[model samples]
Target: MQLSIYSDKNYLPKGMEPVPMLYPFWTEFIPSEKYPWSRLYGKYLEISNSLFKMTSLQEADLVVMPINWRVIRGESWRSKINKEVESLSIEFAEKVANSGKELIIFFAGDCCVEEIPVKNATVFRMAVYRSKRKQNDIIMPSFTEDFVKEYLGGQMSLRHKSEKPVVGFCGLAVKDSWEKKLKTVLFHGAMLTKSLELGVSPYKGQILRSQALEVLAESPSLVNTNFIIKDKTVFLNTQDVEQRQKARAEYVKNIVESDYILSCRGSANYSIRLYEILSCGRIPIFIDTDCVLPDESIIDWKKYCVWIDEKEIPHIAEKVAEFHDNISDQEFLDLQHECRKLWKSRLSAEGFYTNFHHHFSRK
Candidate 1:
């Protein structure tokens, strides 16, 4: 039942910003600013690996590691990651082959999804991508449905395919252009402005659970991005980015005051907000490409919510209006219901762990 999750302090972010009040979880512990394991454990899973040691995966039922420079820290990032990968080489993957233990990697970005030749380790990618296909044999988890169900209560009972004209967005979306000092805000602002014109309810905030809940309440439709991530210290290596706390509050307040939320993939990983939106009892208006969704055979995005092509973002209002006309409140509710069921079965940590256990148990 125990697992090892590798990450560092930036797992949540630091300073002038307000994050979820995640603390005192028996299983949670922040190893260092360079690695944040505290954000994953406690009621989730108790972590016990210090450095990226082969023994960790060899010893535990499963070892979950993030293969990214973001989590790696310092100029030594690439080398450290490769060193660890080499340690878990084919020879290592084989040692734990029959140990009833497994190794799961948190890989969803463009940076580390490339194929790394390793011997014995089993790599599970969180989001789908071409690099994932080349780098490792992808292992899809079973947390999707269950995660949706638990967080989304009554909404899970409704049909979302044809819900009301409500729209909303979950998670964070800071354009960062408003920062007077970080002069590049103008460019980032342009991107945000483009997204807004595309039909996303504009809100200023970081990705916090309550804010996510609030965003959905505002509009029946929702918009999501990678919750938008950057180094706590941006390009200049200073935590000068404006605090998203104000934005979070404003979004929640607006959710209580508005109608639809929009969820879209921001910079990296498909924003978890897609589920969080459904969890809040609203439909997700997702815009993405074939690269990020789960297997098409198992997931029908149109069946649950409106889907727009990544390139078609400017037509967001048109798409939203079209989707709304096609479905009724009952259907929308059903879609929401289906959303919750999907998250519960596939997105939760417990479900992930269970799958990890099964992967090693075989043979």
Candidate 2:
């Protein structure tokens, strides 16, 4: 389908030359030359350039307007950018509607439904970082780094099946404190309030790491690193770069060799390890945190991964054992292959946009 991008000249980055409207917004916060997949941003640009078929505004099937949500300066600067994006969204939505074409406002930051215009347009968000008080239009949640293209390079080989099931997890395990307790209570209480409103229990909590550790301790066939809970909260141990790299290497090795890896939420509700596990063709013991995954309407997540609710943390070992016992050796191998295929086709960014275009075009 022919697509047009709408953006004001001043909304772009200061030094960068004019390019596609979505490129800078999407790759604003991504580090340069850090991870192997950091180049995926350029890959995304190539995919968008080919798929969108950039055309004149008057002769296009879809118009994409990117919202600038990255706070480069401070709160005042963020507010200013938000206002500009809001105004631009309204104007572009009206123009696209008048021209009888679809419009999609791509919000490049965390969930802020208020910034989204309540008009004839679809809103695409990078993260569902907040709870929605009410449903507003068709807001699609997409993540920046959820896909696995070439993170492992030549190391992407099929893992051999082991005699005993091996469950693994390696990450920061935060220590419990008054601060953490308060945050947990507040977050879960808000979720509970929202669940009460929707008449459904999502069973979300902040104690995912601790719970996973407990389950791993009880499991007989498991390999795990000794996670010492620190007094202060640490997402990734960055004090010593070499040690951090070593930890990451060990983490990858364990996950790749093991039959299953524990996928639990970190600070965010969603887990990046889930996608990594899928990319490795290993089953993920997913600890659900009321997460809204991309393309959930199209992707049946339960079929490929072992889903465990937050409330069912106590039975995690039992559930994993049951799942392991039920499947035959051949079935297990098939599942591994199936998981890889799922990532290559449905979870990756290229696959996501390809399917997204097809699905929306038909609709």
**lDDT (CA) per prediction:** 0.41, 0.57
Scored by lDDT, model 1 comes in at: 0.41
Q: How far is each candidate from the true structure, as Cα RMSD in Å?
A: 11.1, 5.8
Model 1 ranges off by over 4 Å:
1-91, 94-104, 108-112, 119-121, 130-166, 169-260, 354-363
Question: Roughly what TM-score does model 2 have, to 2 decimal places?
Answer: 0.72
Lowest lDDT block of 10, candidate 2: 196-205
| Residue 127 local lDDT, model 1 | 48
TM-scores for the candidates: 0.51, 0.72
Off by over 4 Å in 2: 1-10, 13-21, 24-38, 68-100, 108-118, 126-155, 184-206, 221-244
lDDT of 2 by residue, 1-363 (tens): 434444444444444333224554445534555553443345555667656655567766666654343332112211333454445446656766788777765543322333443466665553353355233233332323432333466445565555556777666554356776665566556545534222221122235667666766767653333333333233364678787667656667677767888877654355667777887788998887655666666678888877897788788877777787778888888898898887767666656565556546545
lDDT of 1 by residue, 120-145 (tens): 45555444444335434453432222
